[model samples]
Target: MLQKNVLDYLDSSAARFPHKLAFADEARSFTFGQLRACARGLGTALADLGPQHNRPVAVLVNHTAANLAAFFGVLEAGHFYVPLDLQMPLPRLRGILETLSPAALVYPAGEETLAQALADLCPVLCAEEGFAHPPQDALLDARRGRVLDIDPVYAIFTSGSTGTPKGIVIAHRSVIDFTEWMADACQFTHQDVMGNQAPFYFDLSVKDIYLTLKCGATTHIIPKKDFLFPTLLMDFLEEKKVTALVWATSAFHLVANSGVLEKKVPSHLRTVILGGEALQAKQLNRWRAALPAVQYTNLYGPTEVTVDCTWYPIQREFADGERIPIGRACANKEVFLLDEHLQPVPPGQPGELCVRGIGLAKGYFGQWDKTRSAFIQDPRNPNYPDLIYRTGDLAVMDEAGLFTFLTRQDGQIKHMGYRIELGEIETVLNSIPSMEEVACLFDPERDRIHCIYTGSQESKDIAKLARASLPRYMVPNLYHKVAVMPHNPNGKIDRPKLKEEWIHGNDHRL
Candidate 1:
């Protein structure tokens, strides 16, 4: 059962606006015609793959126009792509690939030269030359090809505490739903220009790719170094007249306080979307002060459900010291709170939040058992057969049917034999006036918890802030200040680095 591929959206967009710019960075800009032709060529080249070789293809490429082409090309070829971070250590990457034994190894033109220097690999396609051996032009032009009903769009690799990293497999339907929802929710027209912030590997790029391809909008790709100069980044947005953008919560905070970008605001920017973490009310206030008319959205979801499952639009004024809730589900998705028995929980009682609908992914790439466990039959829905993914997140709904995220069930800590939610500790940390970003990690070896931070505060001020609402044991034993918290490409906290750098072999106390 072949389904419509993600690139079909781009193909349709190209037909309507062949000359409109589809992708751009400081180095180059691609019109819809050029981008579509490149994707078609890559697809045609990859279509020559034999039946015995049909398996997931893994791609390790940097954030570039080439990666963007591969993103669509892999889907059009009827194979899922495993996106690996370009900056990851070679050993870590080797471990990931050894697990999947992917069919094709896709990389940039010059990367295979470096790859050969490290390990002998197979079936490698130079991205620049991917379209070199194009298919018969007439057949390629005439054949729309059969797109499988359940063919995956892409496979995103995520870390696990044990074993190799896992791949979250998203299907074409989920990608299409997200794009259509975005087109409506954001009110994007062909006039809108979107900026690509997150790397092609991370889910944030989904918003960048689909919005442009499906909605007939223009897109601009941002480089990594520009982020260091938050003010200059804003200037770029202004000069380009970007209408909308999405960013990680950590990034939004950095830009708001970046000092260089203080009210050096862009005039045409409208929607400022954020995700991968909870939004602090005080941070929202700062953003509102700077761009009052801009719509700020808190997008929430794991990689299993495409880019996001739910979103909260911050519309009005809020209290300074509060944390905004995760809010309701987006269109085409339904979120419900379930109790210990997996039955629906009444409003206001905390329960595990579950998701069901069009945004759900096909499954994890190779771990069928794990995928089966997460995807379950929906007990509540009666409109034909339905399956829901247990989100493993604790949440509750208010009288208004608006759901709010509490914390991950895994985030619970049995401290001194008392179960404590990390969200509670993080909220206390946010209450501190000077604290910007806070992450509390438990150190069992030292029998203490370490609170890591980056923001405006002295040690004494932070200590004073900690003692105000927390019991003595709840306070972090060690306080370390750094320039910023380690964040993955998705803009979420990198707790692995936190453990490695600050927690390992440390026996110090405050």
Candidate 2:
């Protein structure tokens, strides 16, 4: 059957696995039947609350089963969901709300105070109350009938270069295509239980959420606090009998670096997929050593590409210093590299990674200018309108058509009349046995390269290693050692924060 709406996934799964747990959190869970009931009921209420159709419905709540229900509920009501992280500051949240101008704002019960603050912007709907509303089948069916594959399903906000967040709007077709390809590529089954680590607001979570619905599998929303203690996280996965893990590379690195996997591993974990940053072989080797039989996949793409356009299933052993290719493009998607002139780069040369096909997002919501800047017409085609998203990420394609991500376009800087990639320096430093984490930044004002890292090695030793490996200009001009590396909410290194603190704020130590 052709799936026009994402709700179709939930409806089919609900019928097939009525009594099975669909989503679960630490405090509560929802069976497929019950989740469908909650969604229908909430959909009816949302339909009655406003007359808006195909608009954004902002959902501000913690990561829980109820939150997932709210997401489906928004879709059931014929509008796209915009998940807002509860931890987001009011200023940023306000900015997003101002830009979204959603038809309604859904919040968990007992958060009336927070909800009320934004009530002026939109109608506030209590998720708990909405779940209790009686389902209007005819009304919901009518709404569902109106939905189309090209309509937006959700909009996830990502940081823009200009400081404001850009809401990346994804259509149902894009997600449907991506999710279908992911399920087939990853070989997901109903028996697989997923341990979801990415926050719902982040696009990475899309795979865990939709894949479970598509496969009729169960998903356990691992608590954010569990990630801090690797042992506790492993225990949760073990207790839940989680067979799959869709996580960020940082989360994987945390567990491997913590040495918890050496002592104890998630015995039932069979598949591990990582993204949102480069996957270092040092940490990956640790996981492979611990779970030799487990399938490991490295995914690459920005949020604008509907989660991921390329994936590399680990096939052979890699040394700690080797780089893993992101592999070929996924089904129903096309990924290619283009140089600054918008021409295909020669094989093995770095170029901006561009993506097209069914998996590409609709574009940024309410920011047409910004959207036009990133999502442009395919230069190769002038006769017809064919769109491709410019990812701004630099990567190199090998002779075999496998892509190896290098760094962000901004991460490549001109130093001493030579263009160098910061990621290359970090990759080299990361290969060091004693180096735990490393980030390279450039100081344009002083014309120096700054290397901030958390490792046991002294600054002098790291400098010596860099001198031996990198060219004189490519070697870091400054090295700062810290006990711990800072990360953002999505688990990627907070380079901007590190730059503010280590590079711009204090340089005396360097």
Candidate 3:
């Protein structure tokens, strides 16, 4: 029988290579059979929660083997899982809970305070104790049989235009399609060893997780703290013999320039995939110079689309500051440039990049208004109605059909592989007992978040307040106090002018 759901991958892998290592983290490792059995046990334990189709079971835990079990468990119970980052602030986490209103909150054991605090909103399931019950084979088989490809497998939350975070739900069919394409395009096999870097909450982990499962490859989860010491990271890679790496641009830059690659090279590293941000030619050259035989690729996509929509395998050398093309769209998917009137733009002209295909998300979890606005009807296909996601990113396609990114059409920025809304940071800054205006800027060269504001509160105090409300990545690294805010002719904040002045050394560092 054809596999219709994501859970089927586990069942097939367990049967084919029951003793083969499926996934390993710093704490422990799990074989294919062990992973499948544990997930089944977890599903049986969560059966009483009434996991219906489309309902969400929010999992709040760190990156660990237990978290993976919770994810598969939710799918086994005929529901979707929303993985939350435990490091996020409580206020931000609460806001997501309010927006999602999940059926239950799944956390690790010994977190009684967290469970009690969120118990009022919904039930909390402990991962350590939750799966203690034996596998209920009948119930698991029944739910598995009912799940369809169109039903959502998981939901990820991204920074919203509004103050709250928006949940983006992806279905099993989308993952199945993208995973199949990636496996064939990249030529993955059971002999490959994947080094997982991105956190489970982030969408980048999707490619690492699903691709490993589809190819029957082993994935070793590098600890977060290891990255701080690049030499230790190199040792881990050398020890695990990681052959493939799908990581953020920052992670590649950190390792390539940390001097560890020059001193000691990863003997088994063969392929390096970068996404979540633009890859600088200088950074690419540094890695290539050290490991000349490695295959490098630039993958681009938003959370709305399953992981990546387009890919560019590096073939030729590039100079410093050169713009890299995002290359063509993936198989079975089409990405074209569309003008403001929803018409096809002329070749070589800048326009919004619109994507049309099955890889698109079902829509925002529950925000009908936002979902309808972003995912609209394809104007060119009026004869038969079809939906295409209007990516707010602007780009230009050349005669060769390759896309070169221009700039973001909105205030959204990808920092440290996280898609953050500048407005979200400004909202929190405005709430901090401030006197006046504020603006957030992402410095691509330095990879820093800059916050400029005209306020009475000290920058240190404001930073402290922000730390309490926002995640560490969203907090501004540099704070500047300006005397007056620049405005355009429309009397609105001239962000361009502010960014120019900040870069040109016209403002005082607070």
Candidate 4:
């Protein structure tokens, strides 16, 4: 049967694993049955508070088992959810609130002061209080009956080019399709225990949340503090008996480069899937050397396409200097490349990555112009309205049908009257044995390229090697060495923050 609602996955799993732990954190845990009951009670409270359907409900809470229940409760109330980062600055959070104007704001217990500050914007509800409300089965059943496959399930905010957050609304069908395909492709089963690294607000967490419900598996929300200490993080993984890991590439690099794996390894981890950034071969080689029997897969996509549209299972060994192919499209997704004119690019040529399938998002919330600009009609389909999402990322395909990510479209900069890909320069710098992490940013106003890296080598020595490897114009004109590289909440290198600090700071030039 076709599943029109994501709650169906949870309902079936709860029936099968009523007594089993579905989600856990350091302080609390929730069984499948308990989670369902909490969600139903909260849904009833929300439905009675605001007799509206198909509106946004912003959730501000810590990353815990309760967060998952709140998300399901919003869906149960016939409304989509919007997760707000607790660590976000007040100004930015206010901007998002201004844009969302949600039907209600749901806050965790002990955050009444924070909730009251925004009461003027909309109604506010305490999570614990809502969960204690009596369940209204008839009202919830009627609300659920009105939901369709195309209804929006959740909305995630991503950084926009204009500095305002662009909320990406994903529908039930998109997530349902992606989760079903991922479960089968990755062979997820009830016995698999997953360790999730992404935050609730990030789209990467979607895979961990829904995949567990679809497969009747358990997921452990690893504490954020554990990531700062590599050995402690390994201990947490070992103690939890985690069998699968769905993590960002930067997090994988953190553990591999720490040399802790050489001291101790998580014996039970069988599957490691990485995404949100390109996975370098150097750090991956370290992981392979230790856990040789574990399965490693590379996933690539933007939030606009569920979690990921492509998957590459490692079948061969890679040299430290070689690039890992992003590989082919996943089931039910149509992934291709287009040139400047929207025409198909020939094999071996780099072009913009485009995707069209059941996984494409509904579009940006309340921003129709931006949505129309990105999700547009396929030029090839002149007779019909076939839509495709144009991802600004660039890639190349080999004759054997393997796709290799090159860089972002904006990463291509005109320096010294020559078009240069900053990623190519960073690749050369990363191959240096003394270099640990590296990124290249261009200053359009000054027409200069700056290299920010963390490693043991001196700036001049690294520059000498870069000069020998890249063209004269592509070599970075400025270099900044640091003891530690800055990263964002999603675990990717905070490129924007780096640009603000390194390029726009007082001492920008070498």
Highest TM-score model number? 2
Give per-residue CA lDDT, model 3, range 99-150, as digits (tens).
8888788898777788778888888888767667688899888887888898
Task: Mark the regions of model 4 whose C-alpha exceeds 4 Å error after superposition.
Answer: 507-510
Q: State TM-scores per candidate.
A: 0.92, 0.98, 0.82, 0.98
Instruction: Give the least accurate 10-residue stretch of model 3, judged by summed lDDT.
Output: 485-494
TM-score for predicted model 2 compared with the true structure: 0.98
**What lDDT does the true structure give each of the candidates?**
0.76, 0.91, 0.82, 0.90
Residues 1-510 of candidate 2 have per-residue lDDT tens digits of 788998889999999999999999989999999999998889999999866689999998688889999999999999999999877998888889999999999998878988888888999999999999999998988888888999999999988555679999999999999988898989999999999888899889999999989999999999888878888998999999999999999998888888898889888989999998999999999999999999999999898989998999999989887888888999988899999999988898899999989878888888899889899999988999999999999999999999999999999999999999999888888988888888999989889898998878999999999899889989999898888899887788988888888668866844
**Model 1 misses residue 254 by how many Å?**
1.5
Over 1-510, each residue of candidate 4 has an lDDT whose tens digit, in order, gives 878999999999999999999999998898889889999988988999767798899999589889999998999899999999867887787788889989888888888988888888888998888888899999999999899989999999988545578999999999999999999999999999999899999899999999999889999999988888889989999999999999999899888878898999899999999999988888898999999999999999999999899999998999776788999999999889999999999899999999999899999999999999999998779998889999999999999888999899999899999988888777778878777899999998889999999889999998899888888999999899988999877778889888888778775243
- The model with the greater lDDT, 1 or 4, is 4
Q: Candidate 2 — which residues are off by over 4 angstroms? A: 506-510
